[model samples]
Target chain A: MTRLLGLDPGLRFTGWGVIDAIGNRLRHVADGVIATDGELPVPDRLRVLHDALVGLFSTYAPEEAAVEETYVNRNGSSTLKLGYARGVALLAPALHDIPVSEYGAMAVKRAVVGTGAATKEQVEMMVRRLLPGAVIRRADASDALAVAICHAHHRTSALKVATGTRMA
Target chain B: MTRLLGLDPGLRFTGWGVIDAIGNRLRHVADGVIATDGELPVPDRLRVLHDALVGLFSTYAPEEAAVEETYVNRNGSSTLKLGYARGVALLAPALHDIPVSEYGAMAVKRAVVGTGAATKEQVEMMVRRLLPGAVIRRADASDALAVAICHAHHRTSALKVATGTRMA
Candidate 1:
């Protein structure tokens, strides 16, 4: 079984979910958000995010990690804030020597819900169906699960291709 | 004397400078850049930057840290890229429990060169004169030193204010 950690990073709230993937099967392990206070300075806020992520890594010990590749937002400042949190999300996993992969939002949706334009509800519903008893409440956590599922699918397909090549 | 570390963060090369501030006097301690490979994935690159910074914090053991408050870049992608590196720059010191300060470019120029409109050469010349042998070669290291100087000035003034308050 391959343990995976998925992260959806934001300055205000960074949502995360963990799952285990063995071949095509995925099992929900955990999901939640790491929130930082708005009143704190950016450095302090980033430290909060960083510390929480490091804690999660130690608790779950996920073998691999996945993060959603954010699209360019129209608002420059918000995008920059997101970038700060996303940096921690990516860095925390790499710091622990876990390989990190990124998936676009579209790819995550297609992998989880069978469509690129699936609504949040659709994604959440499928997240439940695929990983039974996944107690995802927030949109951010559900989205994180979606990305983890996407990684699982991609990794499984890559493994298949490798095996096929070896056989050939 | 208070030891200070100042950082000017970039994805390609993060410039760092260390200085010691004693009342109105400043002494340059060390200066260098941390460069990451462009071909590496962002997470791995961030790890390289993070590791270099962690090493600096241990070596310098700075009591306080300062980072330049950057103006927004017009290009969206570039701004986001900068945000990622800046995040690490700010977080590293904070993680090490160092008090981190920020100064605008104008404030740094004013403190270092006695004018907000000081040219780059003027700032570099003043940094050398103020520190009395700061061997600054790169523009990035000079800017980092300038911010460190600005922090020294501000911190000195703040100390004076606190002293006055206590005396009163």
Candidate 2:
């Protein structure tokens, strides 16, 4: 079983999820949020996120890591904060030489629910339907799990082409 | 006297230069290097740079800040490191609400010596001529001064246009 870890990085909170991938089947393993205290300095808060991610990687030992692609917006400060959060998130898996795959939010939703315009709630519904028994508590965590499942499905298709085998 | 502090941020060394902008003249005030022992963890090194920059900002009380724009190459890791260093540099001035400006390397050189392709030695020579009494110990510091001088020249031109006044 190949386990995949997905991350959604934010300045206030970082969402993470793990999924067990066996052939074309993906099973939800764990998902949660890592929240840092708002009172701490930005750099210190970033350090907290970094340490927490390192702990997660050690506990789960996922084979592949995935992160949501960041986009630039009108507010320069907000964009900068996102960049800092991304830096900390990338550090976790890069330190252990795990290859990271990036996915856009729309692509994740489309892969899991078969619709590019699927809402967050719709995607969450599909994730629950597919997993059946996942203890998903937060919408953010469910989105992360969906992202992981998307990567697993995509990776399976890629492996088939590399092996010169056609999918049935 | 309006003083502009210039910064050249790097992973191993952070170079800083201060210049007094008086009318049409740019007089160099001080310059130095705050180098980290590269062996230290990146976060610890970033902390050192942050502290040093804060101390410099308070001591000099610069009215504005000018930073060199980052260059992207084929190596993704190098680009990421540059972005991290740039983030630390930007955060320092933002704490004091000082207006920050970014100048490309070629533009800095062109503003100082009338040629974008000028060598580092040529730029240093012009910087010494522009401020005869200033001491320049590091090449990085000199480069930073050139950027400050560039911003000074740009602001003077912009101010002239805003006021609709002709220069002597």
Candidate 3:
């Protein structure tokens, strides 16, 4: 079994989830958001995020890490703000020497819900169903789980292909 | 004497400068760029930035920190890229328990060059004059010194005003 971590980052709230991938099966471990005060200065807020992410990494010690790839938002300033949180999210796992992967929204939705254009509600519902008793606390957490599921599926497929090639 | 660290952040190169603020006078200490390879993954790139910032903090032990305020670029993706570096630059000092301040380009220019609309060359020239014997290795380093100079001037002015108020 390999433990995997998924992160969906935002300036106000960063959603994180951990799961154990046992071959083709997945078992949910935990999921939650790391929130920061908006009134605090940007650096202070980022420090909060950095600490929370490090805490989670030490707590779970996941073998692999995945994060949602950012899309350019319409508002330039907001995109920059999101970038700050995303940077911390990406850096935290790498700082711990865990390999990190990025998945786009479409890939995550398709992996979890079997559709690239899955709605928010659909993705949330599928995550709960796939994980079986996963108490997804928020939209961000649900999205994070979706990312983990996607990474699990991709890794499993690669393993299967490698084994088949060896046998042939 | 108060030690200050100033940062000018970019994805490819982050410029940093250290200075000693002695009452109303300023003395240059050091300046350089932290460069990262473009071929590496974003997470790896961020890890490099995070580690470098921490290394600098430990080396300088600056009592105060300042970073340049970002301007949203015309290209959204580039803005996000810069955001990642800026976030690291801002968070590094705060994580070290150093108070971080931000100054806009206009403020930095005015503090160093006596004009808000001063050109880059003018800012570089003024920074060199204000902090004698400073060897700026790059444009980015020059800009970082400008930020440090700006912070020193503002802090000195504030201190003077406080003293004046107490006397009154």
Candidate 4:
């Protein structure tokens, strides 16, 4: 069973999730947030994120990694901060030599909730139903879990087609 | 007479231009490309960009800073590299405590060439006309100068409105 990890990056908080896949079925493993408070400088915050991701990678040993692609923000400073956050997130996976995939927000939402324009609340609700017995506490955590689940769903379908197995 | 410095960043090269604002007149000071060979790693490339920008800042002592906003690519890896290039560019002005502004591609084209959808050649032609004696050696250098000229035009109009002065 291959495991996948998902990340949702932000300046102050980075959410991560891990899941194990067996054919089309996914088993949620763990999910949490690595948050840095405002007292730290940007580089220090990035360092903290790097350390947290290193710990998570060691703990979970996920086979693959994924992140949500970033977009432009009207606030230039905020966009710059987001870029820093993304750099740390990408660096962590690259250090482990894992292939990291990125999905747009719309793609993640569509894969999780069956609608490209699904609201965050709807996604969280669908994540709760889809990941049964998994106690999802944070919204960011749930979103991260949804991203991993989506990738697993996609890969499973692709594998079935490649193997000439008709998936219903 | 405040001077604005504009930068267009890339992994292998960073282009910069300086333009002075004298009342309603804009005068080009200097423009050049800091070229680095492709042998360096990403971190070294960033350090080279940072140091070159510091040298430029000290020499020009620009009153304001502006940069071209990053463009997203469909390829995730390409987008990531562009983000890194932009990060180094943003760090340069922020380190000097200069208030930096970012112009989107369309905004830059409009400010430089009188139309939002103006072609690159049109923008380059307008930049040459505005700075008749500039020694532009590369297209990227010209683009950087165009960004500077665009900001000059943008600020000139804003200054006129703020001071209730008539345009000549």
Encode model 2's per-residue lDDT on B1-168: one tens digit a residue: 799999988768878999999989888789988897789656556666767888998899999999887665545545555555666677677667677888998999888999999998899999888878988888888878888888899989888897885543
Q: Which digits, one per residue and each the tens of the lDDT, describe model 4 over residues A1-168?
A: 999999998878888999999877778899999998779544455556767988999999999988887766655556656776776676667667677878888988989998999998999998888788889889879878988888887788778787786544
Error (Å) of candidate 3 at residue A75 is 1.1
Q: What is the C-alpha DockQ of each candidate? A: 0.73, 0.07, 0.85, 0.07
Docking quality category of candidate 2 according to DockQ thresholds: incorrect
Off by over 4 Å in 1: B166-168
Error of 1 at B145 (Å): 0.7
lDDT, candidate 3, residue A132?
Answer: 96
User: Which has the greatest TM-score?
Assistant: 3
lDDT of 1 by residue, A1-168 (tens): 999999988889988999999767889999998889999999999999999999999999999999998887777787788778888788999899999999999999999989999998898899999989888888888888889999999999999999999999
lDDT of each: 0.90, 0.80, 0.92, 0.79
RMSD in Å for model 2: 10.1
**Model 2 TM-score on a 0 to 1 scale:** 0.57
lDDT per residue as tens, model 4, B35-139: 766885454455566578879999999988888876765555555556656655765666566767778989899988889999988988888888878778888
Query: What level of docking quality does candidate 1 show?
Result: medium
Please tell me which predicted candidate would have the highest DockQ against the true structure: 3
- Which candidate order results from sorting by TM-score in descending order? 3, 1, 2, 4
TM-score of chain A of each: 0.97, 0.94, 0.97, 0.94
Model 3 docking tier (incorrect/acceptable/medium/high)? high
Ranking by lDDT: 3, 1, 2, 4
The pairs that clash in candidate 1 are none
Per-residue alpha-carbon lDDT of model 1 for B41-75, expressed as tens digits? Answer: 99999999999999998898999999998677777
Instruction: Kindly report which residue stretches of model 4 are placed more than 4 angstroms away from their true locations once superposed.
Output: A1-10, A13-168, B165-168
